[model samples]
Target: MARIRLTLLVREDWRDRYPAVLERCRQAGLVIERELAAVGAIAGSIDEGQLLALEAIEGISAIEPERLNTGLE
Candidate 1:
């Protein structure tokens, strides 16, 4: 399946374990692009079919699929 961009929300309680969480995400096949640590977010791309593996990581609270920017209110 095609790969898609995604934003991962890190659980508040899991912030302290950010490094480990990132490692797990890599293992799940995420091509990490940015680490918004201050906001508890991680931006990356992963195979559409591998989304479940990314979501199953222990510290992730939510997964947001990338959306096109239409530049409209």
Candidate 2:
């Protein structure tokens, strides 16, 4: 499947283990583009097929498609 950009929300309780969580995300096939440890957010791209794998990770609270603002709004 083609890769799609995504935004992951890290659970508040998992903030302390952000690095490890990030590693797990990488192992799950996320090509990390940006990490906002303070807000517990991670932005990356991953195979559409692997999305479920990422969602299965315990530390991740949510997974959303990356949104693009065309400036028309």
Candidate 3:
């Protein structure tokens, strides 16, 4: 199956609500493969519709896919 990375931008004040958001994602069939709290970024791969479900969350500042690396590092 094709996979696409999903990133969610959250505010520092809403950090405590991360669990609820994660649960919502789980119910929507989106598995959170990785999470970075310092930067308030959540990375994961899910189906198209599942990804769209994230928009329902109130505190979500932004959501998008991570850019592919060109391996120049």
Candidate 4:
């Protein structure tokens, strides 16, 4: 299976919904690869169906790939 990475930007007001969203992700077989709380960013991989499920979450602003690794300057 090809792994696809996605970055989700969650709204501040929806912080309370994080747990539920995570549960949903798990139910859909999506694994959270990484998270950056400071930026409200979540990176994960999921199948096409799971991706569609995630899009249903209300506070999800944007979902895209973590395309760049800018670790060293």
Which regions in candidate 1 have their CA more than 4 angstroms from the true location?
Answer: 71-73
1-73 per-residue lDDT for model 3 (tens digits): 4556788877677778877676776676677888877677777777875666778776677888878789997
Best TM-score among the predictions, by candidate number: 1
**Clash totals for all models, in order?**
0, 0, 0, 0
lDDT of each: 0.93, 0.95, 0.74, 0.73
Better of 1 and 2 by lDDT: 2
lDDT of 1 by residue, 1-73 (tens): 9999999999999999998999999999999999988888999999999899997899999999999999997
Which of candidates 2 and 3 reaches a greater TM-score?
2
* Candidates ranked by lDDT: 2, 1, 3, 4
Question: Estimated TM-score per prediction?
Answer: 0.92, 0.91, 0.73, 0.67
RMSD of each: 1.3, 1.2, 2.6, 3.7
Residue runs of model 3 more than 4 Å from their true location after superposition: 71-73
Q: 1-73, model 4: which lDDT tens digit per residue? A: 5667788887887767766656666676668887666667777887765677778777777888657778977
**Evaluated with lDDT, which candidate comes out highest?**
2
- Candidate 2 accuracy as lDDT: 0.95
Minimal lDDT window, size 10, model 1: 47-56
lDDT of model 2 at position 10: 96
Candidate 2: tens digits of C-alpha lDDT, residues 1-73: 8999999999999999999999999999999999999999999999999998898998999999978899997
